[model samples]
Target chain A: MGAIKKFMYINRTAPYGSIYSLEGLEVALIGAAFDQDVSMAFVDDGVFQLKKGQDTSKSGMKNFSLAYSALGDYDITKLYVEKESLQARGLTVEDLMPLTYEDQDDDYQEKPSIRVVDSEQLADIIAEQDVLLNY
Target chain B: MLHTVNKSPFQKNSFDTSLRLSRKGSDILLIEDAVYAALKDSAIAKTVKQAVTTHSIYVLEPDLMARGLQPARLIKGIQIVGYEGFVELAVKNDKVQSWL
Candidate 1:
């Protein structure tokens, strides 16, 4: 077989504070469209993308929680959230996307099936990728 | 691995680590506040030299412009890249890690 092209997606922003998370999602979507073996990881503020019940309406930003749910349809599974981020915010993985598979549609798996990764695991996983994109 | 340094070379640990790890398989990308290192005579610029001697490094043009500076005269061998180039880095490197 030829070289396996693995792409890692790094998100480093809060959901409502800036365009970083939304843009990250768009870039990941585009990457999956091109058929890359992709993995998503969140660090620092990036963990906000996986938080549950985000109401950006008060801030006048479009809620993108649904977009995250759709990542499975594109086979963009294996999402990881930094454990430190959740701890810093006094939250646990349970407060984030609660399910990994969604029954909403058969075309994709459920949302919130993300794995919680500590910094060391994150570094190890990152070292294994062939391609890495950040948002 | 390609390391993305978006913070000031002094502020975040990424810059220093990226440089130390700048072997044949790794690169350092200056993004966000990290682009501050691209300025002439800045603290970070001075430190970047050590990394350049061993590895490839670059700065994001948009970030530099956002800070109202040009990389034309500041860097000796550092390259400039657009957002698309950032994407290209992801496509080419074995791994991409962001130091935020």
Candidate 2:
């Protein structure tokens, strides 16, 4: 690691409908490999990116939503879902996929990674980042 | 703020909207298909050229190359940046607003 910079990847678009969410995830993974402190924010329609039971068989698109769970494996475990975005869409955390990963530093125990936060908290996170990539 | 637009200007209003909303001195980065707007003779290019006086405009070099757009074909005064430059711009700005 040269210099670890705080990096935040913001997702505001829905997955499948556009390439932003998928491409945003790609950047998050790449940021992790660079040894930067990586965090993800799901806002607006982006909360759908974490929705459970996504089947793209008919759409002929690869269901990359499952890749959200793999974020923990990459040590990019900070996933923030905006509370207001979900409420506005009439969705709750239950509607999202339960994302967890084994904590290698803690006896390899499985633990949840997603954090449901308010817009204020999300703003703080955004302001604290050294770099923010919005998609 | 760092305003990034990845949609093609011809197909989307992101560039026009961002240009209107961005404060003077803010930076604009055109990436992905949005790189097409940097074509020297395009209408979007004319818009961007006008925007350059108030905002710093940049085109993602890799995306331009991926779309087979030569640097010489880009409008004058727009800077071309790589992924590293993308990171640098994000760090340089206080916040980022992606114009979807």
Candidate 3:
């Protein structure tokens, strides 16, 4: 009956190395289902999450990168990355997506896209959120 | 005048959230595992340093020693608060948020 609420999901872990990344994604997906406007901020090693070509298959893992694309369909469009993190890792928005594992075989597939910003914006974005869940 | 908890945010979301939104003068102490910010001299330390100058920020001395971190490595304005000093910090801050 009130207005739709805004939710912020702060992810601070990398995938594979720990269970935090996958679990955080599950939480974000659940939040999206409720139609609560959702956004995600990837910090520290968490930036590894949106990498362009993830090969979890060889590591005996399901390719979670596919799940990222599904976020757009759920209206969870605001995926933020720290510019400092990006530079620290020698990464750029262009490096994040534009290729996929399928492309390794010369197939056509669109990978996930990462929007980059600096720490200043990261703090501001956190402050702007009505409900912030950090995991 | 300030308090700080160096624990990872997600590991202690409730405590970290409280620290972030606490009164302007309140401080959130950082040290040990929380000292990950100081490792690479990253934004976390930068933000904490700025906050400490205007507010209060404390670091756990024991934890830093365990990790082989020296006081000289710590950013300016940040103080090394011992265990007893830590308890005193909790008593001083209006509310205490433990991120562990």
Candidate 4:
């Protein structure tokens, strides 16, 4: 395998109203298959993509929110959620669906994949990324 | 006339521009990401509060709830409206302008 580069997918748009969030998720999953170090940062309205109990039945739109749960299976486990964005939208971490991954080295112990970070921490994460894909 | 804004005040000038160009007594509805401008204690809260006196400001209830924003957290003068209310505003106004 070649040297694994860090790939960060930055999501800033809301779901349902636009196609950005869903497309970003799909691209992230496809990118994960390449075996690179993939992570996702949810900022601004992008945080809504991870909201729980999303009922699209009335809207007649596909409920793609559930697909976020499968990110762990693709080994794209690092999901960074910005605290400031959540606070601005009056959302807390509890409002989001719980996503977890299993640690292979630790007897497959389950661990949370979503990391709630402040803007400062998120800025550092963005600065460290080798490639940034914005949605 | 009814002016609708669906972009964030922090990210775009949609809210400010709509507020500026909209005539007094016009209905201003905030939906989608634009609901952020209705938040209390935000950077744009003061401006929204000021605009409330000259315009009838409304925020989409479903959009607010979808964003996990409580109605109480919104600025004092802004009214919360449902989809039906949105339709009523559209019917009441002579024209509808979306500030993209």
Candidate 5:
């Protein structure tokens, strides 16, 4: 295994506006294959990447929001969503997709990995990462 | 701080804004099209040279090559790094701010 470093992926762009959100998800998935400790922080318009029931058929672009729900299967369970970002967009956790993972340990109980944090707490999380990749 | 800029200076003002806002002695890594700013004799190169007086600048080698820019074409005082060096910079810096 490679050196296990703390990696925090910062998502600050909105979904479908630019390619940042999808590209960020691609990198996070790639990082998971490396066996590093990976976490994601949703700030600014990045919180929109997690909104549920996104219909992109009209735009002819593939809707990739469902990929966020599958992240836990890769053992990437740390997803920090900034509270202020969501509130500024007039969204709540209820507007996000229901994401839960079946933990292999502890009898495979399902648990939610999405964490709602304030800006201050998110700052702390950013400070704690060994590597921060912005997308 | 290690600042990574991936946008072109001509298309976006992020490279200029990053130079304006970064603290003195901060390192800026020009990746993707931002490497164009480091090209010798370019208009933005002069401003980038001025930035080198206070900030240590680096460019992603692969990106430069991908864009068909030769290392010799880059202005003095700017270094080139590969992917491993990119990770090293992230580790060496206290914080990283991306110019998006």
Candidate 6:
């Protein structure tokens, strides 16, 4: 009904420490219904949300990290992760879950959606957004 | 762009990460608990002092006062602004990024 607006959800909190990380993901999933241009940026401790093998069994909390792999179905494929954030936390791209989306424009070929960017590059990406939602 | 950090730098990496990622000449506004980073003698003062060269740094006046901090105690090059200034910063910038 309206022009597609760029919506970027910046996640800066760690998972399980508080509810921000999960809430951010939930809102992003819900926002997908509107079909606007959506992207998520994981910065600071937010990178923890994508870490592989998250076990919450002892904490009794649900392991929602798996839900990220489903984002491709929602058509929310862009997930920019800050490289410095990962290094500061002693993590690498390999430590994250392999999230991919089938590129409809490219004959439905599966393609990686996570882009690990340096701070300078991430700043440029952030400046181009029409709306920024922080969590 | 304008970047706002609301968490304390001493307690969180929000301030450092924001400072590192914000583009050159971008406006960085310290508000809420983040105003503490503007103090001249704080552990982060050196970093704030260095950031001023590349970015315009501002602290919420009310938040600073509420924390018992005086303007004279703030690091040089750091300006103090009120709520109106906060709104103005948001309006002036093409976008606002909050480091929570």
Task: Provide the global lDDT of candidate 4 against the true structure.
Answer: 0.87
Write candidate 1's Cα lDDT for A1-135 as tens digits. Answer: 465599998997655445777888998888787776788998865765676655543234466776887777777778988887666544577657654655355665445558998999989999999888888
Q: DockQ of each model against the real complex?
A: 0.02, 0.02, 0.03, 0.25, 0.02, 0.02
Per-model interface RMSD values are 13.4, 14.7, 11.6, 3.7, 16.0, 14.2
Off by over 4 Å in 5: B1-100
Give the TM-score of chain A in candidate 6.
0.97
Give the TM-score between model 2's chain B and the true chain B. Answer: 0.96
- lDDT by residue (tens digit), candidate 3, A21-110: 888999998888887778899887677677655554323556676687777666676788888875654456765643222222336354
- What TM-score, computed on C-alpha atoms, does each candidate reach? 0.52, 0.57, 0.51, 0.82, 0.57, 0.59
Score residue A106 of candidate 5 by CA lDDT.
Answer: 69
Per-model clash counts, in order, read 6, 0, 11, 0, 0, 0
Candidate 4 off by > 4 Å: A87-91, B65-73
Candidate 4 has a TM-score of: 0.82
Off by over 4 Å in 2: B1-100
TM-score of chain B of each: 0.84, 0.96, 0.70, 0.98, 0.96, 0.96
lDDT of 6 by residue, B1-100 (tens): 9999987675589999998998889999998667767866544677888999999999987666444456776788998888789899999998999999
Question: Which residues of candidate 6, in runs, are more than 4 Å off?
Answer: B1-100
lDDT of 4 by residue, B28-100 (tens): 9998778878878665677888999999999987777665567767889999998899999999998999999
Better of 1 and 5 by TM-score: 5
Residue-level error in angstroms, candidate 4, position A62? 2.8
Best by lDDT: 4
- Report the CA-based lDDT of candidate 3 relative to the real structure: 0.64
Query: What digit string (tens of lDDT, one per residue) describes model 4 on residues A1-135?
Result: 889999999999887667888899999999998999999999987887887766654335677888989999999889999999888765789978899999777898999999999999999999999999999
Model 1, C-alpha of A119: deviation from truth (Å)? 1.3
The candidate scoring highest on DockQ is 4
What value does the lDDT take at residue A104 in candidate 6?
95
